[model samples]
Target: MSNYQNFPPANEDGAASTQMFRAFVDEPAAQPPTAPNEGRRTGVIALSVIIALVVVAGVVYLAMK
Candidate 1:
């Protein structure tokens, strides 16, 4: 029906296709990277509280039994 439905454009002109390719593939990949520890602090505190509560509950259960 349409040429796009078949082989499509191969970017033979190299300008619009290269721009499209870089826009979808390369540009977003060029984002500034974040530190491994950037957003881990809050999660660590919440997890620590959960772990501590479980530990305390276990200790109390053992003492009562």
Candidate 2:
């Protein structure tokens, strides 16, 4: 009538398998690497602003003429 009598014997191999599965599940994920050229974005933004200013200036000059 006892619950332990109904269960089968524990295997050593099953214990090792469970430990490996738990370690794999609990491990933290790796972060992605940062870009080496992040500073280049500022240069691109400055270039875009300069181009926009030149276009605006050209339009103003034509209107004045």
Candidate 3:
């Protein structure tokens, strides 16, 4: 039973536990300090925009014909 339930002893005041919980909850998720893929993301966005433009132009051309 003890092996299955190994855990740390609880704080007597409980304030520390509450503060730790609050700090953890309030903290923002960790993000990469630098966006190494930012350039790749921008390139993908540009390619998607270009593809969309080509599709729209093709539709317009078909409609005109």
Q: lDDT score, residue 17, model 1? A: 77
**Which tens-of-lDDT digit does each residue in 1-65 have in candidate 2?**
75665443565553478779989999999899998788899889999999999999999999999
> Which candidate number has the best TM-score?
3
Give stretches of model 1 more than 4 Å off.
1-38
Cα deviation of 56 in candidate 2 (Å)? 0.3
The number of residue pairs in model 1 that clash at the backbone is 0
Q: After aligning candidate 2 to the native by TM-score, how far in Å is the CA of 34 from where it should be?
A: 3.6
What 10-residue stretch in candidate 1 is worst by lDDT?
Answer: 5-14
How far in Å is the alpha carbon of 17 misplaced in model 3?
Answer: 28
TM-score for every candidate vs. truth?
0.42, 0.46, 0.50
Estimate every model's Cα lDDT from 0 to 1.
0.78, 0.84, 0.86
Q: Where does the lowest 10-residue lDDT sum fall in candidate 2? A: 6-15
Candidates 1 and 3 compared: the better one by lDDT is: 3
* Candidate 1 Cα lDDT to native: 0.78
Q: Candidates sorted by lDDT, descending order?
A: 3, 2, 1
